[model samples]
Target chain A: MILPSAIALGREFAGARFQIAPVRGLSVQDGLVIGSVLVLIACYLLPLGAVVALSFLVPVPGIGNYWSIFQNATVHAVVGKTLWISSLTVGLTLLLGYITAYALVQAGPVARKLMLAGVLLPLWISVLVRNYAWIALLSPGGIVNSILIRWGWLDQPVSLVRNSFGVVLGMVHYMLPYAILPIYAQMARIDSTLPHLARSLGASPRQAFIRVFLPLSRPGLAAAAFLTSIMSLGFYLTPAMLGGGKTVMVAEFISIQVTETLRWDIATTLSTLLLLVTGALVWRFSHLLELATAKPKT
Target chain B: MSDFTYDTGYMQHLEQSVRRETQGKTVHRRRFLQVLSALGVSIGSLSFLPSARAQQSELVVANWGGDALPAQRDILAAEFVKRYPQIHVAFDTTGPTPGKIKALVESDNVSWDVADRNLLSALELGRQGLLEKVDESIVDINAVPSQFRTEWGVGSYFFSFVITYDAVRFGSTPPRTWKDFWDLQTFKGKRALRNNVEGVLESALLADGVAPDKLYPLNVNRGLDKVRQIKAETIFYSNTSEAQQLLRSGEVSIGSLWSTRAQGVKEDTKGRIDYHFNEGILLIAAWNVLKGAKNVKDAWRWVALSQDPYLQVALLKKLGWGPINPAANKLVPAELQAQNPGSPENIARQIVVDAEWYARNYFEVQNRYLDVLAA
Candidate 1:
């Protein structure tokens, strides 16, 4: 079954490629494409190559850096913590974003425009400002605590913006738009009357949503999860500010090694590892998405 | 009328010449190529001219920017420029973290002539051969205390990590020693500590009853154990401003903060936030010239100028950084003496940070410190 679907996906991709193939030989457009590829190689790949080379060459060369990092329990702990936080952020962002995107799809034209503006407006603000805003709202003496205490919810202000919870809160707030836009785009492409068709076929509302709408939006859910998790993996400032130095993430740990400890070998080695893992994850996710979308007609 | 006709005739002549030039396709293309090449050459040379000129007279002094930028510019750089009008001083305030200094020196593009860093950085970078030795003949090394002077760097200023607490919260029974700081049951408030291991270990050791003099070659495990004692009720602040904010906002009623930031917070809160100098970990901020600095002589001149007793006093007045020069001690008024970290009275009470021990063990110890915090 999997083989048949994979073949179908390969055939679909080949058909799409042929559909958009250029007609003629080298032209100005071809030259521009070649030039941009060369520029990308110079700008992006060369620096990445240098970083990988430095990881091996520094601290007397060989795989000593990698060997030490692998044995270092701190690196393992930091990597685990980073993965845990990224997964948490991805899950929260998807749940909230899916709800918002669904509302957007069902709302009136004017309401949709206003909701979109609300979502996209935050994206325009600087990330630093957003993180700081979360701090102001969730700190011990902040507005949330103030309100909770005034209502006699508790005697003491709860710890909010200085732990894993705060880091995830800030990250989810920042990642909401990223999650919403992709899911909303996918939802918009989905036929609105499909659920109605399912209902006419004697399906309950919940059943219709589960069987028809959820499967259709799976690609968008996967896209959102992939984007938020990838972004969360690299987050530095949110975790730094919100975690209050307790919740050490990979990016912050790498920065410490590079700047404070002067351990470039360790820093570059961790970076190279992160790059390889992310590359593998990206490849796997893309393949999974392709398989999910491919259908072998009976 | 004659001028207008001449301009029109010249325009007509130029148009006719362009038409003549374009009459031959090959010549037109060749002329275009020549103009493009000339434009590229002139623009490229123009970009190089200013950099070449700057290299002759400019000396960059890198320091952590904030309130220090304006103070250093108005005082130290201004004095240096006044003495030697031939040399101009510029400030690179991106901070001179040791890693940055190493990268700059190794890349063979050392931009900073003199960097304002800590004693540990000076010793570490000097050991790695990233810094130029201080020219004794140019800089008066004896101006500062012997402990603060090094072959590759000289004392820039003195600061300390002191216990800063909310005066309103503690009132008359304020926390004094690190022991009091660790007494969470009595203090009854959240505490803040520096995220880095530099002064944190000293504070922890002092809290654990280690004598000031015996704090060298720190007992890393013991210090971390003491830190873990209060880790549940503590917040580790990464930067000085965060430490101040933690105190000012009452997020943490007490924090171990830099003397300079503690002072700022005290004044900002109108004395509601106060710091104690007792058991303060005194650390020296130093000036080191990069190994391949473009203006070595000018850099030495800047360092020498910074050491002048009067200039150091002036900096003390503007910023609360204690003057490194002992002579500047006498110049500090009685009113500001209590505020000065290097004052005779304050110095007597505080423990000077063991720079040598940190220079060797900082990386390993800091990793452990971070581990304890994260754990």
Candidate 2:
């Protein structure tokens, strides 16, 4: 019985040794691909995982963090604000971007190039600088306020940067590009003659646009809305700077909680919630066209 | 679908997008790691540079982002090397204290040997057991203000949070208290407040008529309500950079800003701006040595040199941050007493933030505060 057991053990050892051999050059290309994919996934998920882990960890084990969401009035309010801002930003940006893209397609080549250049110029300048510029434009003593004051539009410098209006304006300015590019790309692909032909056939411009153009541009519109929503939801500096003190968004609130209250669990909980919100939005975006255009099974 | 490609411009733009996206993928895959490695080399060199003697290992000292940080750090470096020739001091900078310390400690890869953390974060980390208690013998705590020195941080006083405004904008009637700030009808057009909790709450309560000395065990609900009330009307700035820019550009006429930044505004404008100490919040950045630091002796010597009044005064004059060393009084020929936060007299008036309290309650208050604003 001992001899038979030893023989079986030796066979198992030999099999294990056999498994270790000839991994040599066996598709290092495949290994590289697999390794690269693993690294990329790890890179993406690890930080997110850590954030989630941090969220659930304190108040000494339980669903304390998740439960705290209900207890914390601030978290609930900020989340609502985030949703409102994101929706408004997406809606406005898509409308404006579509208009600009349409205008670009209609303009003369030189005019279009210049217009395109103007549209993309904000992309190059710093967001901080642009936000500051907006502040300058909106402040009471600054250009806009000075002009409004001179023009007798208002008695004093209206509070712009410190309010939600300013926040929206600045965000829309940034989000406009997100809306513009995709729609413009879609519009350029659309046949110019379709609208012209519709006009010749007695279709009004509005009808032609609604019937012909809107459906064709669904992908771009979806894309623009999706992109704008994601960006608007995650904005920290814009709301913090432009909103002044009156408006507090999720990002600013998270920083405040961590720094001022030292409530690590709550802070992480909020951050994790934000991540989930954005992640869900991203998932929605990735499947936007699919969900919107899905056909019923016969 | 085929008729979609419009003109040359559109085609060119499309081409550019395709090219850019393709390049982004390449950069993300291969170039990202390459660039990271390259940056890692430079950053590694800065933070772990070998000694000139090639005998001793490196001690990395991480600090803030600014012209002033480098200037102060340079003096510390020179003096550090003068006394102990064997050891080398390497410096690094991370953007903010809370996020950076959390990242370093949680990652279990302590990238920093020593870091610049303020009183609040220092105390917070000390409670969390993230910092190594300073070697008392080397630190010479007797030279430090008893109030300033703590188990976690060695105080090198920076600045007080002073309310600075455009003198031209405010006229003779400057803001005397947080109440002055609350009365937006008189002090109109966007008023500013720092986004952080400790100071803002104190200011809001002070505006609500809470005495500075009695600020702590702060009435959280009352403070949150005040914050919401002010936040409903006031604009908030999070970063120092944003606040300074807004003030300089005349985007904001009145806001609570760093004393150094406020002083810079005053000095830059030849006193066109005025900084009021009526209800300032005192904050100081303290040097903290990490627990796992490989070069403790070197870090201590560096800390010792950093304690010098000459160096401190030079730092005071050159950089806007106030010097902690009482000896810096004369080296700084400027009459800092009444004006600068570091000055002996100015330091007395401002509310001392109970950082220990902040460390404990920051998140709860911040969340509540934000909620109130959103509401």
Best candidate, lDDT-wise? 1
lDDT: worst 10-residue window of model 1 chain A? A14-23
DockQ of 2: 0.27
Candidate 1 per-residue C-alpha lDDT over B62-174 given as tens digits, one digit per residue, 9 for 90 to 100: 88888899999999888888899888787777677777777666655566789888777889889889899989889988888788978888888999999999999899999
True contacts kept of each: 0.57, 0.62
Best by DockQ: 2
For candidate 1, give the lDDT of residue A281. Answer: 78
Docking class of 1: acceptable
Clashing pairs in 1: none
**What lDDT tens digits, residue by residue, belong to model 1 across residues A2-98?**
7887676666564454432343686556766886897686456645765676787777768999889999988888988999999989999999999
The top-ranked prediction according to TM-score is 1
